[model samples]
Target: MHKEQEKVTDKNRFKSCMMKPDEEGNIYCPQGHAFTLEQRKESVKGRYPRTIQFYRNEHCEGCPLRSQCTRSKHGRTLQRTDKLAEMQIEIRENLMTETGQELMKQRSI
Candidate 1:
């Protein structure tokens, strides 16, 4: 694989093991560190305007996995945009299916 692809795969592998927000919008890490919504902003321009929410957990300060998690001095922050996240989720679901796999193979060729 290319270097960029390997880097993305490595990041994804770690992200799969990290915390994800629940349906109610609550996010807690594996160690039970609660994340708070830090900021919300609307995109100025895109195919469609989107509202993004940024969440961070202050508890990541002295965690052993800090280096593996993030390089930020403050803490780890997760950002999600309304329409983009939903669209990406849909695309990810489609990419997991047989048809999508075939399409990807054709594209690769």
Candidate 2:
């Protein structure tokens, strides 16, 4: 019973993430989908885990556009109040690390 419930929940979450905007004032997913804010609210209601991992090592390790992304010398920094903010920060920080600097150097080469 528990496993079944978990599967249902996972399915709902997957649906929510893929939601997009529709012609009405509502959100839709890419496949001509539609989801009401109420449904979205209920779906996401919980003490959800923080999805953003804001560590220096992780940030320094995998940024492709580091140089043109930040003004910080040590590395780029990021702050997020939402889920996508972390990804945005990660991309920005990648543009400002030593590795990013090297990439910049290579670009100039």
Candidate 3:
């Protein structure tokens, strides 16, 4: 019982140490091997379907590190998490809006 408790504690600590905080106070760990935000956006934009599929199928298939990265059988596919993607979309939309353009100008100053 004591050993089991110790193992659990260690696991929690390890997880905590591996986490990185984003600007929005969310935690993520860009470790192991995965696509970057640019890559994910490109995939969504249909700019890199074949490349994405290759990673989703050939590279990630049957790898021992899958558990640490992705739960999908095709390997760890990177889709934008809701908040992250939404933020990007919002920013893009804002840039098109008059108010957003003003804000961008101010940011440049």
| Top candidate, metric TM-score | 1
| TM-score, cand. 3 vs. native | 0.30
Worst 10 residues of 3 by lDDT: 48-57
TM-score of predicted structure 2: 0.23
lDDT of 3: 0.45
- Per-prediction TM-score to the true structure, in the order listed: 0.68, 0.23, 0.30
RMSD of each: 4.6, 20.7, 14.0
Runs in model 3 deviating more than 4 A are 1-55, 59-79
lDDT of 2 by residue, 50-70 (tens): 543231212432445444333
> lDDT for each of the candidates?
0.73, 0.41, 0.45
Candidate 2, pairs of clashing residues: 20-28, 20-29, 65-95, 66-94, 66-95, 66-96, 67-95
Q: Rank candidates, lDDT, best first.
A: 1, 3, 2
Residue pairs with clashing backbones, model 3:
none
Error of 1 at 64 (Å): 2.0
